[model samples]
Target chain A: SQKIEQNSEALNIQEGKTATLTCNYTNYSPAYLQWYRQDPGRGPVFLLLIRENEKEKRKERLKVTFDTTLKQSLFHITASQPADSATYLCAPGAHGNNRLAFGKGNQVVVIP
Target chain B: EPEVTQTPSHQVTQMGQEVILRCVPISNHLYFYWYRQILGQKVEFLVSFYNNEISEKSEIFDDQFSVERPDGSNFTLKIRSTKLEDSAMYFCASSEAVDYGYTFGSGTRLTVV
Candidate 1:
């Protein structure tokens, strides 16, 4: 079975610290991995996308890296602020159509 | 930029009853999709639509489920008979890129009693 795993425990870090979240999968080689930020009662918002061939992708303060050999993707938020507190989700593209498999997501808290 | 929009932000339906969820996708998007998230769970793909028909669908989208783009703007999901397990947030999304960049709507919360 294909599975995407993320830490279930909430992560708390001081404001201005870098926040790191991990996503790992098993059994399938994904073409690309994507990261999204979702707030309570809101839809998941698109953040960044990285292909398996690409080592890393960055957008403003957000950075994502994909290591297909290890079947893992790391998401980092630099100089994190309190407002950056939200659940981050990792979704990997499934072969064939445009379907994707998503991790349960990791909730992060940036304390100011 | 125009975003996807779903109607009746919240819906309550009786189990065994038929229900239809409606959505209006972004005008320029070529691909459409439906995904569901059970409370406290990851979003799961239900079906994908393109070129005026369904391109792909998951096992969760069984015979009881059907999708249609009745008009240029309106896309709908019809549940032949709603079940308790069908209760969840149904989200409509659109993607223009083959790489699968999607813009999602706020979602319609369906509660089956």
Candidate 2:
């Protein structure tokens, strides 16, 4: 069976430190991988997308790295603040499949 | 910015009662989808619609669940007989293409009593 796994334990970090999250998948080769940020009772907001051919993508303070060889992706938030605290989700999709396979998501809390 | 709109932010229905959830996807999007997330669980795909028909569906999308593009702009999901296990947050999403990121609606919280 195909599975996407993220760290279920909540990650606590001090403010101004870098926060890193990992996503690992098995039995699937997706054409693209995406990251989303979701708050309580709200739908996910798109953050960034990295294609199979691309190794890394950065937008402002957020950066994503994809390693197809390892079937894993890493999401990083630089200069993290309390405002960056939220649940982050990883979604991987195949070339023709319109639907995305999402992981359980990892929760991050930046403490002051 | 454009968004996918869902009706009835929250719905409380009796078990075995039929309920319809409505959504209005972004105007220019070509693909529509329905996803559900049980409290504290991962988002699960229900069905995907394109070109006036279902392009794909997950195992969770059973015969009791149906989706329809009633009009050019509106999409709907109907549950024939609601069950306690069916209570979840149903999200509607749309995208311009299969590979593009989807814009999701605020979601409707369905609580089956």
Candidate 3:
């Protein structure tokens, strides 16, 4: 069976600092991994997707690195702001499957 | 931007009753999916639909649950007999392709009393 593990502890960081979150998985070699941001009482919003062959992908202040060898991925938000405070989820999926295996998101709080 | 839409943001139903949750996926999306998040838990995949048929479903989607694309635009999930444990937030999502990112609806919070 496949399993995904994310930090259960909430990540608190000051404004303008960089926040990094970790996602570790086992028993599966997903073709790609995705990150999503979910606000309270709302559905998740897509953030970024990184493929297994890619080492890193960036969009504005967000950066994601995938390490297939370790079966882990790191999501980074630079110059974090209070608006960036939310629960972030990681999902890993196979190449042809429409379903995704999601992790228990890690809550991030950016204090101003 | 086109978005996936779900109706009845919250639903409270009695145990053993039937409930139908509705969703309208993005117009051009080819793949549709249903996922649920129990309170304080990770989102779990329920089922995936394409070409008017179910392509895959998880064990959590047992005989009690069924999905249908009754029309060209509307997709629905029907719970034949809701249980107290059926309380959760059900989300509908769609994507152009499996590899592409999905757009999820606001979700319908189901509470079985």
Q: Model 3, residue A67: what's the lDDT? A: 99
Tell me which of candidates 1 and 2 scores higher on TM-score. 2
lDDT per residue for candidate 1 within B1-113, as digits (tens), equals: 78899987999999999999999999999999999999999889999999998988999999999999999999999999999999999999888875766888999999999
Sort the candidates on lDDT, descending order.
Answer: 3, 2, 1
> lDDT of all predictions, in order shown?
0.90, 0.95, 0.96
Q: Which stretches of candidate 3 lie above 4 Å from their native place?
A: none
Worst 10 residues of 2 chain B by lDDT: B94-103
lDDT of 1 by residue, A47-93 (tens): 98898789999999999999998999999999999999999999988
Candidate 3 per-residue lDDT, tens place, B1-113, comes to: 89999998999999999999999999999999999999999899999999999999999999999999998899999999999999999999999999889899999999999
Candidate 2's C-alpha runs over 4 A off are: none
Q: What would the per-residue lDDT of candidate 3 be over residues A1-93, giving only the tens digit for each residue?
A: 789999999999999999999999999899999999999888999999999999999999999999999999999999999999999999998
Deviation in angstroms for B38 in model 1? 0.9
Error of 2 at A45 (Å): 0.9
Candidate 3 lDDT at B46 equals: 99
> Which CAPRI tier for candidate 2?
high
Worst 10 residues of 1 chain A by lDDT: A93-102
